[model samples]
Target chain A: MPCKFCSEKPVIQLPNSERKLCKSCFIKYFERKAIRTINKYKLIEENDHVVIAVSGGKDSLSLLHLLKKYCQKRNNKIKLSVLQIDEGIKDYRDISIEDTKKFCKSFGIKLHIASYEKETGKTLDKIKKQHKKTIACSMCGVLRRYLLNKYSRKLKATKLATGHNLDDEAQSIIMNQFRHNIALSARLGPITGVKKDPRFIPRIKPFYFLTEKEVATYAYLHNLISKFNECPYCEESNRFFIRDMLNDVEAKYPGTKHSIVASFIEVLPLLKKKYKNQEINSCRLCKEPTSSEICSACKVKEKIKS
Target chain B: MPKIYLEKEDKILEVKELLVSDILKSLKINPTTVLITKNNELILDDVKLSKEDRISIIPVISGG
Candidate 1:
């Protein structure tokens, strides 16, 4: 099929619609969609320092590239930086970081690298070897998020951007529903967290509505990433199952993920309002904002130590 | 037969000519989770495979 807007051969079919878009047209559509999400949510404002959290994956690299393009076309007031958390997985992060470094160099952006080994005194691989009963994603998610927020704040960033897409958000919504975790759901959205705290750097998802396939296509077309490598520890997480389930549903019913996110966005305000009054406390160990006395990252560190 | 390269497994399969959708179905890979490329260029799901086609199935899902 030809592109919906042009005569060129279509490169991708929009997950929510029958419309197919060629490379050039899809790139514009993708960027415009992200811009709309940003503007509608006020994700980035003038004079704001935006630190993009990159994982050297397609989603992150595409986001970093998109923001670079957006910054070029918009006001010069918004500052851009890149942050990468090295979970210290052998053969996985090592390979992907090379891609990220090349991308940052080509784009002329400085890249900040933080590591679990540096801050927590143990690599994820070592921690996983020792804590055989603990899930890798559980520990990695907590520490990666901790470092992202901690370093973003240290960088004096006003907003931290991530590469999360519609599919990811949809998976989280379903995962939260399955686990009966409503408060976590409240923290899930384009702009995360129910309310702002001084130490918490607001995180934004520019590709909030775009599908994973769309981001992959964009990354492939631009060669933003050198390879498509899945984490060695992915299949152990609940998210992998949720991701497959959501993908199956999306295949059977087009726009299933989109519908999930759209509906969630509609009720997000209420979810926030309901959970906003909940007090935010600083983790006594790390001093990071958390709902409990000790943050999840510190807890994981304690487990590793034991 | 069309040659299909599975990016995740780093394996190639020589399979019967079929539509892009059928190829994914045969492999049990959801279309939403991957992209099909022909000769290093992206192709639509409706495209039919030909004997000369060298296709690559790129997995889009990344867990971190």
Candidate 2:
């Protein structure tokens, strides 16, 4: 097969790496795309440190790997760090953190792991008990995001990067729209970070244009990603079902992921215009950007206690 | 359309006794990862969805 990144002739697809690009343009094009994403979405400014929300998962790992390669290729001076949240999901958290640490160690990125138990004196399993039938990941997610923004700001970083790819974005858009969340779908387009607030550490998804299969295939081909499957605690997530359905759609439509991503660009501007009248205020507890008085993270924690 | 917590009208979710996968399928969303909740209850049903319920679906996120 021809190299996926370029149409240069006689390019061979290697079976042992995350990319199907020719060796010549691989680094250059990857860096260009990263830069393009930033420029396209205005994710980060030059000379700003970036903190990656590393999960040690395929998408996140792939994002980190490509970012490093891109940064080095561009000789960008932005400092990088890998931050991991310890949700204390028994065997799962332990293995995921170990893998993240190992990858960061080998790849030479600074790694930070904040345990949920350590921060709040409670683990996710314990927190789940506070709310009956509430999926554990929800509470953990809010905390992780809160911490990421907090720590990112504490570290004086300019932006936070995550590994949300095309499939992920699609699921969110559909879910939000189904529940009359047009504003949420409005915020679904590609970007390096959120534009609403500065204290919130704008988040960017460089892989917004990529698909889950491409990430997995890249991980599988390159021996890059961790061997673990999805976290066991995520069984309650609607994304799993959405994923299977999208895969079936892709099998029939071939390029659905790209189409969905493309659609976001078209819809995002209009959604923003429509929701421009909505009021946003800072979270009272954390002083971070939020529409609510107390951010969801703090509220969830308070719920856990009360 | 129940009393769902609307996160500024963006991250809408259906919190029912329905399976996470079923909701995703119904919504035509490709699942990456998400957090589900309903009225402070931890729902485990994958196929059952009740009406007049408050549900939340947060996108899969990871950070520290």
Candidate 3:
């Protein structure tokens, strides 16, 4: 059969004859593995609805494709809605939202688009206006997650799926270590925390094992994955520097990255026992579980003028 | 050029004796918008930079 994504002619001929995946098989494998991970983890419980944060990037597109494939195979009419949060950064998010819409439309997935301005009553530009010392990219990240959760909860979603892949996880581990943040680092794996509250929807990473290269390849073979390169505004992110630092180290040290994360996971049971002291209590203001008076999202939203 | 080291790569990059804002501008990052570590401390983007600094940037990582 022709490749499922692009209606491209055929994907039977591998450039390297010895390769196991024709271009199509290559793409399918990544999506299949993602599905396998989700199923294996039992991440999707019955009566659970999911809100996918589709960033119109390679990893997320592949993730959505796999989720659709999984739903098809299992004949589960699961309620999945793709939420595209536009950052209001000129063409960057616009292009991405368009691609996300196209992918969702092609698959018949229900979709919702929330622009920073429309949803928040303020644009990222406006947020930047208020906070001069802070970078716009920084606020965008915070707002996206905050809004994603708020919207997901309002929609009654039981969980959230993001397009974070293996490299993303590994990078986070190394960066956290480099920053001496063992506590936060420990929580950066496939399943974060299960705060089993009605208001909180746990997030799951289905692309946990797959590498960055695999995700990119899947998107390429699938074709037209909204070609927005790195954001012009976020290159200064210290994470990018850490990313550069980890590049050679990860390659030379082999499982060095994975082991760092694995070590954290290994110690999590003990770590929580030793360090996690109190039962999760509600934010003093919003009733969200937090170590502080207000949840991070609520605090950020407090910045937006009503 | 100030010798800002991104030692995780174990090599030094020649950065300027610049303010955090200029550096972020050069790096394409908007400041106060992401996490910045200098010599193991989270430094503000407004802090001045010198040759002897080791820096790493971690945006509030949200994956998985």
TM-score of each: 0.97, 0.72, 0.71
lDDT of 2 by residue, A34-137 (tens): 56876777776667688898877777888888777767755877678888888877777788788888899988999987777876778887777766677665
| Full candidate order by lDDT, most accurate first | 1, 2, 3
Chain B alone, TM-score, model 2:
0.51
lDDT of each: 0.89, 0.64, 0.64
For all the predictions, what are the DockQ values? 0.79, 0.03, 0.02
Which residue pairs collide, candidate 1?
none
The candidate maximizing DockQ is 1
Q: Candidate 3's residue-wise lDDT over A57-99, tens digit each?
A: 7778877887777777667667788887877766666667777
lDDT of 1 by residue, A1-306 (tens): 799998899999988788999999999998899999999999999889999999999899999999998888876568999999999999999888888888899999999999999998988889888888888997888989999999999999999999999989999999999999989999989999899887889999999999898888899999864666778887789898888888888888887888899999999999999999998898998788889999988888888996
**Candidate 2: misplaced stretches above 4 Å?**
A1-35, A129-132, A192-196, B1-64
> In every candidate, what fraction of the native interface contacts is reproduced?
0.83, 0.02, 0.00
What order do candidates take by DockQ, descending? Answer: 1, 2, 3
RMSD after Cα superposition, model 3: 12.8
Give the local distance difference test score of model 2: 0.64
| TM value for model 3 | 0.71
Task: Write down the worst ten-residue block by lDDT for model 1 chain A.
Answer: A223-232
TM-score for predicted model 1 compared with the true structure: 0.97
Assess the local accuracy of residue A298 in candidate 1 as a C-alpha lDDT between 0 and 100. Answer: 87
lDDT of 1 by residue, B1-64 (tens): 8899998789999888578888887888888888888878999879997787889988888745
